[model samples]
Target: MHAFRLTVLAGAIAAGAGMAAQAQPATPAQLAPIVVRDAPHPLDASRGDAYVATRASAALKSQADLLETAQTVNVVTRAEMERQGSTSVAQALRYTPGVIAQYGDTDVRHDWLTIRGFTPARYLDGLVLPFGARGYAQPRIETYGLERIDVLKGPASGLYGQSAPGGLIDMTSKRANGERVREIELQLGSHARRQLGFDLGGQANEAGTVSYRVTGVGRRSDTPYDHVDDDKAFLQAALAFQLSPRTRLEGTAQYQRIVSDGGGGAPALPVLGTLQPTSAGTIARSRYVGDPDYDRFTNTQTFVGYTLEHRFSEHTGFRQTARISDVDTDSRRVQIGLMASPTQAVRYAWAFPESARAFQIDNQFHTALTTGPLRHRVLAGVDYLRETAHFTESQLNILTNASGGYALFDPYAPQYGDFDIATPPDGLNIDQRRSQLGAYVQDQIEWDRLHVVLSARHDRVRLDTHSRQAAGTTTDANGDINRTTFRTGASYVFDSGVAPYVNYATSFQPVPGSTRTGAALRPTTGKQVEAGIKVQPEGSRALLTLAAFQITQDNVSAPDPQNTRFSVQTGQVRARGLELEGKASVNDSLDVSFSYALTDSEITRTNAADTVGQVGNRMAFVPRHQASVWADYTVRSGPLAGLGLGAGVRYRGSFFGDLNNTHALRPVTLVDAGIRYDLGQASARLRGMQLALNVSNLFDKTYVANCLGATGCYWGTERTAVASLRYRW
Candidate 1:
């Protein structure tokens, strides 16, 4: 089945490439000048408050190189993605500092990621992707469908509205660049993994009045874990039209579907034993009872949006955007546990777990205005989001006789018998509704050889929740929650290759449930102060950035002194760090990018009984040191002009899994290498053709990527290699 799917995908890519090649070519006169910068720097001048996608050539800077703006940002480029053979967003982020990917039993589905000690907030073209506890199997948006990924570290509450303090990831989609282009790629790797993708963009009409771009990807792969497999498909299309000489309009839509049949969790480990744990030792006492027969999960997502822009005059313009998105997921999994005493005779019991479903709808609108000198760039936006989660949990209480002092179950099949079990109501439902409104203004001032920018924003957010259960009718005492936050920043530039900036930002998040004493906990607050310097020397293709930051979060919560399970707002945490990043293109033959971070996070105050000495302990999963480096060398002249060699290394320091800092996980160091050969031609049936090979985890290092408190820990993958072929016109 997987082979057939791969064949069909390959055929589709080939056909798409052919169609794109047969299309008419666009003339140079129709193409616009798109700037390519050495780093991911914000627009020096105000175009609008909202971020706009620029050309990849301009945004393909190193994660560290983008830190000069006083805001922590990481940029992952398409070239890096190809060289690393990144199959998913998680894989692509491996080399990014302060980001960690936690893989479950299956490699394709069931992957989770965290950034800056918190879960990642997914975004596509600056729009948030709805999330759920049960992993959303939404087809891992293929990198081939993307031009670049920008990660803004820390609370982006000012612009993103309701969000986590962790960070935000923005995926920039491939768009029409007023140039006729076509590309097709095929990848083959271990575990029978196969993938095919295609992208095409060009002017759709004469006079450069209309343009369009389309991208598609399909993949099928089997995991090393027993009895697990995954399949995914995706498609995206965009159209742009020049309404008038000063006005432009664009519409975009994308669809994705994914299906997976696998269920796995981290294996439990001993506390005071070896530095590096092995799955072999842990699985010995663990039964590989696969999830119930009905265990499977699937996800589907669709997004559509439009943007309109108009230039009122030479120095002023206005733009407005609106979008709607929908996501649905269905999952079923059986509860499995490990036995403490494997030497004793025992029976294994199975639960008849039913299913869970999540459905979400999101709508948003944004408008911006930009004007003249001493001028103001103003932005206003609003968003409405709704989510419904439903699940059915079955209670199982049965014991079966053990054979040879051990319980055994078939890996592919498991038996469940009813023995006086109580079943819950048909469905348990939880519904959430969120509304947000925001406004911001920024000013840009120009002097002889100096430029300065000042900006501020305010946001108002509200959340409402409702739930239905069989036990009794319960209403959230907090009812409707509201919060308001503010932020400000300033940047100055000098002609001598230096730009300095400072920023003060704030964030707020509401806690869902009330405290033990029946008092509603106010929203938590986070504040940060940061300063940075950016350098771009004259006649040099290198960009360097250095930054220092201090952040504090007040009104943190902990278990109530009276009630252990109930939480109370009586904690404060602080984090201070320094970062260095740089990117350079040396004489068009070599490109290098790197970043490093040193962070110190600790609890400033805590009322919890067990958290006194833990105040100075490091935050869970936050490495004290992290760094990455990637360099690629291309043959500039000769018969091998298009050949390239790439090498990269990523390192992370040891981190604790618990707040108390008792359980520690070993650090990880990974190396990757790749080689590519491009057959270049100006204009032909296949204007460009290329072949490449990538090897990840070259040394097959064994380490844990993440842990769930004391329960268990996830392990990293071994070495893997992939080969790919590409054609472009």
Candidate 2:
């Protein structure tokens, strides 16, 4: 089967190239092209743009055409996200293939979704964001400050050390581009939401050699879940300077504060009546298990980074980047246990407080040279990361084994007694220090229509953890792990714009923990084999891609089948899938995107000693079949020339909710719509202004997202509508 697939792929490439060559007249002017165009608005989002982005930088360390990258890469452009009125990074990726926008539909707290069957790491720019591995320390990137989002599917440990095997999502931040721009927006939406945002940028020096950009967003709102609030304040500033013709310097600083941000909102509550029928009655989606007095959550994060670049010549350049990050969070919530009886349940108060301080640096050197008829672009780089953190958890039992002290509650009719709120004492404290050092090399070899990429990386990872119990006695768990990963791929780009490619990549992730006698186990290893074809007719804005892949992961950490409390690294998972996607600027007035994915993911091996009976079950939260289509249209020339309309449909097939495959999550289909009008059409004074409105889950269809049996389940997001007015100068 593998040989046949490769044979067919090779034939397609040859035929495409042959047809293109015969169609285009061989001209000297075309053979030696002049005026190569730079990527269109790749690092900037405020300029004129389209839904389909032709280039991405995440596939390779440098910006390159996606057709020849030989990877399943998706870019969610700023224009596309803005048109849909996306409020979060996950929302922006709704239409992309293989990305589960909302894992269970209601995890508004963190970006808790999967890419290609697994939870992917979040990246800012080309570097890891260093979120804590044991706490609720995820970064909540404000979409308003982003230039774009690039998703690289499959293993990438060859370049990025210790990555999520399913893939990685990198957010490109907005930067100063020496262009005059000013924008401000006001928005109103569901849940009594109100928001204000602004982006202003321009040259800092008359020579246009220096530039600066400032972006900010502030909002306050109530959530559909009673007593929970959605509030945030964020600001980011970027400054760039062209010190010399071949050297440049850029710096950025960002600060964000969030209260009850889309995190842990679902985990704090218990589910019942929603899944089936409970003796208490059906629980409305608006049910809040946390008491208003203890429902507080706060996260404050700050980051500063700088980039220095110098070009020795047009063919060679070196760059170095460094960043410092500090994050802190404090949260309090009331937890509800499964119904003890038909009308009563146990409740408790819990607290999670954590903080982290981190530093990271990366240095790279890249050069291009030609040897005979082959063009080679070689890249060598090294990076280092060091992070120190304190993770703490506290609880006060209210009901039995529960906490702020466990109390008895009735779900059918809720009540918070007048008893004074109790404070939970820290029950567990963990101080951790983690670090990693990695070096990698990559070479892109090009000859005629054939492109080959080879890359390898090695990393040394160390973890030191100290745990303190309620008695104040502390114990340490420390270990060091080392691994090497690699990737190899070859692609053929036909003159007809057909590119067929195949690649194999491996991943390495150090499992954090110690064994019975304080020793490190093995790291989790993963490998993937991918083959795909990408077609983008010459001089066209449309791209169509079809791909098939298989991935296997080994050494997964699980509990000991022999001892439920101890862990062992003897488990495996396999995922195979087919994906089809198309994006295009169909015409001056229309833009469209569509995608379909069929994922077959299952647990292949287990330490039943460890996993109970989940060995052969499907991975939870991942659907077998998913598909979506979206389109936007505008009247280019007419009385309605400034009016635009958009609509999208998304479908997710049924899947299991538990590792044992007991709970079955039903399939669901959702619709989204948008409308925008250029206010300038009504008055010349509003030439640079616009007004827009967007609605998601238009029908308010309710569905179960995740299920853990009769004990609990999750609810999908409810209908949401927002309107905004914006002006740009």
How close is every model to the real structure, measured as TM-score? 0.80, 0.92
| lDDT (Cα atoms) of all candidates against the true structure | 0.58, 0.77
lDDT of 1 at 517: 60
lDDT by residue (1-729, candidate 1, tens digit) is 222242222211110100010112345563555333333223211111112212221111111223224465666766557666777787777777777665422245444666666665677655566553233423356667776677776766665555666666877676665667688888888667787888777787678778877888887865544444566788888788877887787887777766656432332333211243333233322232343333455666777776666667554555555556666665444333433433222233322222222222223222223344342333344444443333333333233434433343332233443323233233344444545555554443443333343444455555454444445544343444455554555555554567787777777765655576656567777877878877777546566767788878888887776777467887888777887777666666787888888878787877757544767777776788889998888897776777889989988888877677776777778898889877663224544788888888788776666555443444566677888989876
Candidate 2 C-alpha lDDT tens digits along 1-729: 000010100000000000000012245566565433233433322222567877777777776678888898888887888887788887888888888854544554567778887778788867788667474777678888887888899999999888868889988777676767688999999988888888877787689788888888888777777766778788888788788987888888888887773234764334457766666567777767666666577788998988888889777888888889898887777777666776677877778778888899989998888999998889899999998888888856464423544467776677866544566888888788889999999999999889999999999999887777788766677888789999999899887789999999999877655565556667789999999999988767777989899989999777665554346777898889999999888887899999999999999987756435778789866789999999999877778889999999999888876667787878999999999999998899999999999998999988776776665676777898999999998
Error of 1 at 610 (Å): 4.5
RMSD of 1: 7.3
Alpha-carbon RMSD, each predicted model? 7.3, 9.2
Best by TM-score: 2
Model 2 clash count equals 20
